[model samples]
Target: MAKPNALHTLAELAQNDTEAAARELGRLQGLRTQAENQLNQLTQYRHEYRERMQAVAAEGMTSGRWHDFSRFLDSLDHAIRQQTTALEKAEADLLAGRSRWQNNKRRVNSFDTLIARADAREEKVAARREQRTNDEYAARLARDNASRLN
Candidate 1:
């Protein structure tokens, strides 16, 4: 009776754990994909910036315009540095996310173990109840036969 209810609660808890982990995995996958895309785009931007700088150097702007060209290059250099930092941060986050996913996977296995234990307990309770019923029926039958004989 109480055993069955406790088993039911354990089963429900296991189910809830599975559901929550799946949802979290889905969300993490989406974030991971987005981060990968951003990293690729940043890499491409860096390549294009290098080519543009090379083209500007080939054009060889005049000394009168040197300061302005230098300032522009400096600005692009700063932007590249900033993008590098962002890319590193994104990689770190991706690693951390994968670690978390693995940890959650391990946690879900514990829930499965709990579910198994609950199922085993329920089976024992059910077997005991079935045996009790059989005993009661046998007693009733013996009483009836004795009365009929009398």
Candidate 2:
């Protein structure tokens, strides 16, 4: 019987690692999408606010009202900046996760290849042993026939 492959356990471990990395990549991608959506929402809100402010200004708004609007707009801008930074970080994390998954996949493939080669070698050895046994059996039969003829 062929001996069990020694690297089979390692291959299984690598496969598990690859699966974990893929899950992490998916999670990071989801976070990045959420960040992008939040940024889009903020931008839309900011545009609508500017339009409303402009209409109010045309109707001769008070100075205090103008100051308040300016302060709120500044706050919105700061939030947008922070969200942009968060989106960038999330994208970076997604890229890193993809890299990790790829590396783990490669390791799993390498181990699979090694195990296949080992199985092939064992099969070849078994085939040779079978052939040798057959040859010895044929030789014995021939010698027995020659002795009976003599």
Candidate 3:
């Protein structure tokens, strides 16, 4: 049977790995949130810009001003599209990070199970040894008493 200390060390290492994985997962989630927030802000800005431009046009805007607004709106639309792509990539990364963390957690749990089983087995062996020793001592006393009686 393996030593308890060795099993304990292995379990501790597995736990550390699980913690590291969790931290990495958290970092990835934070990055994903940031990406989402950036995308939402860009979309909102584009909507507000369009509304403001429409209001200005209703006030009899010149052709040059209208052209400038159109170009700026187009750029905002392009930026929004790019941000959407970035958000999608970040989501993908977060999913992968979650998977890694789950795997690590499972590993830690398996190690814990192994340690529990080992301890149970060790206790069972020790109990059996104690019982056997007691039985031998009783037999010895019985033999000694029988010789005296004879």
Best-matching candidate per TM-score:
2
Candidate 1 structure quality by residue, lDDT tens digits, 1-150: 234465466556656766776676677667666766765776676678667756876887666566665676577667667766766666676666666666666666765576677677878989999999999999999999999999
RMSD to the hidden true structure, all candidates: 4.5, 1.5, 2.0
In terms of lDDT, the poorest run of 10 residues in model 3 is 1-10
For model 2, residues 68-121, the per-residue Cα lDDT tens digits are 999999999999999999999999999999999999999999998898888899
Model-by-model lDDT, in order? Answer: 0.69, 0.93, 0.91
lDDT of 3 at 73: 95
If candidate 1 were superposed on the true structure by all CA atoms, what would the RMSD be? 4.5
TM-score of each model, paired residue for residue: 0.58, 0.93, 0.89
Q: Any residue pairs clashing in model 2, and if so which?
A: none
Error of 1 at 105 (Å): 4.3
**Which residue pairs come into collision in candidate 1?**
none
Model 3: per-residue Cα lDDT over 9-113, one tens digit each: 878888898899899999999999999999999989999999999999999899999999999999999998899999999999999988988988998889889
Question: What TM-score does prediction 2 earn?
Answer: 0.93
- Higher-TM-score candidate of 2 and 3: 2
Give lDDT: candidate 2, residue 19.
97
